[model samples]
Target: MSAAREHVIADLRERISLLEGGSARKVGCLPFGVPEIDAVLPEGGLAYGALHEFAGGGSGAIDGAAAALFAAGIAARTKGHVVWCLTRPDLFFPALVQAGLHHNRVVFVEADKEEDVLASMEEALSYGGLGAVVGELVRLPMVASRRLQLAAEKTGTMGIVVRRWRRQTEASDFGQPTASTTRWRVSVMPSDELPVPGVGRARWFLELMRSRAGECAEFVVGACDDKGRVDLPSGSADRSNTSGRSVYSR
Candidate 1:
């Protein structure tokens, strides 16, 4: 190889070593607002430089909008740019904003086919300096996922894969083809009644299917406010106090 080429390769290797070493150092965690769930994740939040796979729930168990909102809320709270690549262009931004994702931080890229979606997602992941990249596609090949994982690692960003329910068969069979640090399944839970009239709390069941750090478990989390941010349901004592305050004020 030419001297210039050798020099370039050496420089690249040094950069990779720095990144790998820095990844081991603890960066502050970004809370998802779900205490129980966060407790299980490394760094007490989603790990950076890793792939996170979201398994599709059974029919009617979960909807894509709800899942998008859930993930979007996390991205919003982390205060980073999010690239949402989807095969469908019909994303409900209003709902996403309601889920606490700032419209300005989100960029929606629609693809005509699943292949295009994967291609776009890979590109977005490679661009670097993003908070998170979310891809909603039918089926993601294991090789493609591995490439994305490497890109995310180089950028120190998070990658979220939202597989369609119809493709659950293949996705589940393939598992997470990359060296993703974690995998989770999110499903909508029955809404809880709010103290106020005409309002209800959004609930979800988060199943940690795979984690590099530990065993998997299921937890329940509820979304409060119009933004759909997840948190643990209030205790009875807290609820009673809230009710008393409302009554006294009235």
Candidate 2:
């Protein structure tokens, strides 16, 4: 090969490598306030401009609700606007507000079917300026997920997938391979035991099942509040009253 031609070929190879590495790029992150998770995540927190999947550990409404709220909290962290596509209209606005995603900043798009929700998510991601695009789907195949991933990279928008299934059998679909940058299983954990006879803050097990350039880890933190912020882990709390935002009802 001629020297000039060889140099051109090497440059082309470098560009292809950069494109391939984009899947695991540390675009940006939203901190969780817990050191354990932050220590393991790339770029200090959850990365934006990539698709992250979250599914409930079990096949029930409570589990599904927890997973949805988990994703909502992340959506609340996005800049500009948030677009949410769902097959059902059950997202309680008040609960979302508590998680920091306000009604005014969020645009909810209701779809008749899960397939439609996925389609909307991809389309919404294509247009720039939105902080994030979230979709609730029962099953997201690898091909569909790759399209969403590519769209996020092109536009620098976060993509979140909340996996909630109508049938118990369909819950198994979460195990299928996907092109998502991260995969998580969020489930409700027992709330902290209050010293007084009153309910305590809701807790969740945020398990990182897959990360392209990070560790598979788990975090148990106080669930998100009205501003979409999670408290430091209860074990780390010096006192129950230490956290100012103690109103925890979901």
Best by TM-score: 2
What digit string (tens of lDDT, one per residue) describes model 2 on residues 12-46?
Answer: 88777546532223356777666777788876777
Q: Which stretches of candidate 1 lie over 4 Å from their true place?
A: 1-28, 167-178, 195-197, 224-228, 234-250
In model 2, residue pairs whose N, Cα or C atoms come closer than 3 Å (at least 3 residues apart or on different chains), thus clashing, are: 98-225, 98-226, 99-227, 99-228, 100-226, 100-227, 100-228
List RMSD in Å for every model shown: 9.1, 8.3
lDDT of each: 0.66, 0.79
**Top-scoring candidate (lDDT):** 2
Q: Give the alpha carbon lDDT tens digit for every residue of 77-128 in model 1.
A: 6546789888766665666666777678888888888888888878877766
Q: How many angstroms is residue 1 displaced in model 1 relative to the true structure, after the best TM-score fit?
A: 34
Name the 10 consecutive residues with the lowest summed lDDT in model 2.
Answer: 239-248
When summed lDDT is taken over every stretch of 10 residues in candidate 1, the lowest stretch is 241-250
